[model samples]
Target: MTPIRPLPSYLVQRFHGWRATTYQENRAWYRRLAESGQHPRAMVISCCDSRVHVTSIFGADEGEFFIHRNIANLVPPYNPDGGYHGTSAAVEYAVTSLGVAHIVVLGHSSCGGVKGCHDMCRGLAPELDEKTSFVGRWMDILRPGFQKVAHLPDGEILRALEMQAVLTSLENLLTFPFVRTAVEADRLTLHGLWSDTGEGLLETYDPARGLFHPV
Candidate 1:
């Protein structure tokens, strides 16, 4: 990758000026939040997409939701020796350490990571082969989904892949001993959400209906 220059000295000066005003308001909120520490009601697993702001969609503020984000918002099945377990670590802290009651796996339309996985599966991006980069290994969790829906129409495949990823993550969540215990004891609930970027709608899993219903 080509190196990019840092902000011009003047931009840094302007940033400090703007940050001072915002930081003051942030400080007031933090002071109150620090009093009781975080007692979030839910832990959200979402994609690292700038367009999909989970808090804004859910009408939540700080301390209300524990959020974990990553490429394609993946949750690998619990592996004791998983090399880089950033997402799983967050789950451990959120479910065990923080004792969050609900966990939502938020998948979205037109996910870049999902698209990349599809490309890899179709042999469109052989450069990202299993032996090469971390992303290749990281995205392997979606391999089953891709294989299952690869032959379908593009639109159906995309939707199916999104939902499949959410279901897969939910299965992964249960692999964690703490999460499994809490769930079995009725202490935790797992939900899968599909956010439509084009329609700007939130669809939640409906166990009774076995479908994603609008929220």
Candidate 2:
């Protein structure tokens, strides 16, 4: 079922007017994209949270970034038949087909997935039956993340867990053969990014320093 009675006039008018100007600026670009197909510079794996808009946050134009959004911006291990291969397939396409130079795992503060991990850690989450199966399985990807930050202060745990998840996904990305091959050949780079929604801050993970610092 869908509801359709609350359309805001201003927004509706703006959207309608936008396409004309947008098409003018991007007509050729769209034609080229349609003809040559996507050759994005980077692939951004980000949370589906409405507040975190990767393209808008980075000011990237159409076809500039290939993005995949999931409940918690996670990258599961390469499982060819784990029922749904949406996210993994997106990564494969970005690396192998699109030849994206960089793959960035972007995590953010106040993530629902992080919150779910916290709940699962406390043994307060729902049972792992068939009906509630995916929640348990999906959140398992962040088990090490929660474990890594378990000893930290309660207030800091969520953010730390989120950051650790980004690192975990970065490692998980290498589980795919194409990604590993690209990285080894110097055709790919992996990055972890954490955005503080409340404070409007962005940090990039530094593998050498083992910490995320201002970008």
Candidate 3:
């Protein structure tokens, strides 16, 4: 068996620092959380972008949110083929087990995943078209979104497509039977949001208007 090496020195040092300060300062709180277990109010589906900090944005404490992040922050249409589906598994658990009251799909500007989808659709990036490319296959979830924005000017598609990711995820989420049942029973609600990372701006989707308005 391969031996597991010690953590990187920087991470070890950081852990030590956190253990001395933040962990110590909140030891009792941490212990209480451990004993109580988590009962987060919302399940946040967000992008894998390191810059998109979920907890910081909402001022949520530890265990307050069940966050699932992936490339482009996508949630594929519910498919029960007995195949591996990490995102779907997370959603199922959050809705059926955790009983989260809300599900939030959060997208962001300047997303590399969005750009990759755009480029791939336009034939600007062939590598992403290969079946062996995990990213290409995953980005297929957003191809419909591209079709929605394809008619717009080149400068507008990226941001528009970014918002489409949030919308697409929200739509796909309902394809799950558990999620659909919960929503119909008024036990769960879904939301879509997009953030401009550089501008620190936020916008929310309004189904009534079918547009994203800044907040």
Candidate 4:
């Protein structure tokens, strides 16, 4: 293979700027974190949306959260077929190795992934229906979620589907044996959240009410 190229100038400049500011100001904290390794309390499984900033949302510092991002923040039902499961691997690492006490499924409004699922379910996205489409196969995890909102109006289906993704992930998470065992032993808790990107609003799922409430 050819030698790897250097990072883009803009990204390199940004790194330097951050190092000169944030890193310099918190040099001791950074060193301590590096030495001690991460002992994070929570694992946040969020979407691959750039607008959803997990750190800024919770005012979290470095090493505070073990984050795993994927399309629509989905967690597939447990299956040990020796297949490559990136999201499942992250969850296992976060729960089993990191010993995170909480697992948060963070879904956001106007998410392209969720919209894609809505479109695919309704036959509007034939490209995503192809067997060779990685995104299509990955998004099949949300097919059960889309079923709940399939009958809704066009104006409501997308948002409903977004919320469903969070709930679906929360449900699928328990399908993992370790996750279920930890939760049963009172060592782990699962949470579902939906954020309105434009309004900077967050709503959490209330299991008792089976609904989302403003947080």
On residues 67-144, what C-alpha lDDT tens digit does candidate 2 reach at each position?
A: 999978899987787577889989988988888999999999999887888878867676732355786778788888
Clashes of 1: 0
Model 4 TM-score on a 0 to 1 scale: 0.97
Judged by whole-model lDDT over C-alpha atoms, candidate 3 comes out at 0.96
lDDT (tens digit, per residue) of candidate 1 on 1-215: 76898889999998898668866768878788898799999999999989889988988878999999998888998888947788889999998889999999999999888888888888888876858777777788999878878889876887888887887898888999989999999999999999998889989888889788898
lDDT of 4 by residue, 3-54 (tens): 8998999999999999999999999999999999999999999999999999
Q: Give the per-residue lDDT of model 3 (tens digit) for 1-215.
A: 76998789999999999999999999999999999999999999999999999998888999899999999999999999999999999999999999999999999999999999999999999999999999999999999999999999989999999999999999999999999999999999999999998888889999999999997
Each prediction's TM-score versus the true structure: 0.87, 0.89, 0.97, 0.97
Model 1 ranges off by over 4 Å:
1-28
Candidate 1 has which clashing residue pairs, if any?
A: none
lDDT value, residue 200 of candidate 1: 91
The predictions' CA RMSDs to the true structure, in order, are 2.9, 2.7, 1.4, 1.3
Better of 2 and 4 by lDDT: 4
lDDT of each candidate versus the true structure: 0.87, 0.88, 0.96, 0.95
